[model samples]
Target: MNTTITSNGLPVLPQAKGNQNAQAQASQPATEAAPAAKADDSVKLTESARALTAAQGDKAPAIDTKRVEQIRAAIADGSYRVDAGKIADGLISMEGQLNGKP
Candidate 1:
């Protein structure tokens, strides 16, 4: 049997006469037949995943709100200072780590 694709990219298959009649009968269900039951979906977590979730609990990582407020206040008063040397050192450290250096 040959398969053809339409302009819309859907695969079109040549159906047999018996198959077409069966599909039509299936489309129009019997009046005595009951409706299909709804299925309940659920997620099953691995042992390691469940353990990690239990360890973390419901709380998120703690943030230094006081330090954040202090930084905001400093910026507002034009007293905030940027340590270029410290930033450069950190970048150099990251590069060294990425290169597999101690």
Candidate 2:
């Protein structure tokens, strides 16, 4: 049996071919088999996966352009007033949501 030294300098132990095995396998020369063909590699997505990919591609932006334009116009006309109480309420609600509270 041939032994090869590993990276840590320890010799690799050969697999035990016990005498209990059938004689035919033992008599045969140990030859390497051909590796699998790389060109045959292929991908197959399920119907749900394809639908999900299409749905992701078809997604719309979360920001509403019309509302944004309105807000921008209000700010430019000096009519945009900051409601501190409303902003504080929104922040508290957000904190509650983040902390998993109702």
Candidate 3:
């Protein structure tokens, strides 16, 4: 009886002549496969992202006075508490959604 051992100490079955030939063919370089094609279009940025990049190092647009007053009132009345965990979770969720994995 013939016996074979693998690198991991596992017992290997002896291959028949036809099985060996098949394995050799399988191991040969696959000439039929073609290289991946390059993308024709360049990657695109969102309109908002492009605008933000264009506005980099410039002063941001002025906020509306009514909106600012409302925010100030909310903060003064203790109704504007910051939830760090919620903000973090929201940012993480938004990132996952943007990455197309959500």
Candidate 4:
């Protein structure tokens, strides 16, 4: 009978003395495998941030798609005219708004 100690220092099952292969196989390490656990994810938001996100759902988009389409069509049809006075006034108005002059 052939007997050997396992990795845990416990006596394992005996094999026939003629089987040198069996002794070698038993001495080799046995890989221990465990099942993987599912991963968990979490997110936290401040009260104001949560309210803003919720409110955004009901608000209109910053850029109107319909207006964009109209502008694109006008440009394609050669009807979109650029007014220097209007642009200059708009720039002045923007500057005033930026300076908080209303």
The 0-to-1 C-alpha lDDT of every candidate, in the order given, reads 0.61, 0.61, 0.59, 0.64
Worst 10 residues of 3 by lDDT: 30-39
**TM-score for candidate 1:** 0.41
Instruction: Give the clashing pairs for model 3.
Output: none
What local lDDT does model 3 show for residue 15? Answer: 34
Q: How well does candidate 4 match the true structure in TM-score terms?
A: 0.34
Tell me the number of clashing residue pairs for each predicted model.
0, 0, 0, 0
Q: 3-78, model 2: which lDDT tens digit per residue?
A: 5333364433323234224553454445443343354556799999888777888484477979977876665554
Q: How well is each residue in 1-102 modelled by candidate 3, as lDDT tens digits? A: 955423364534433234445555554433332222333525689999888977874666665989866766655444555679999999999999999967
**Candidate 1 vs. truth: CA RMSD?**
22.3
Candidates sorted by TM-score, descending order?
Answer: 1, 2, 4, 3
Q: Worst lDDT window (10 residues) for model 1?
A: 29-38
The lDDT, on a scale of 0 to 1, for candidate 3 is 0.59
| TM-score, candidate number 3 | 0.28
TM-score of each: 0.41, 0.37, 0.28, 0.34
**Runs in model 1 with CA error above 4 Å?**
1-61
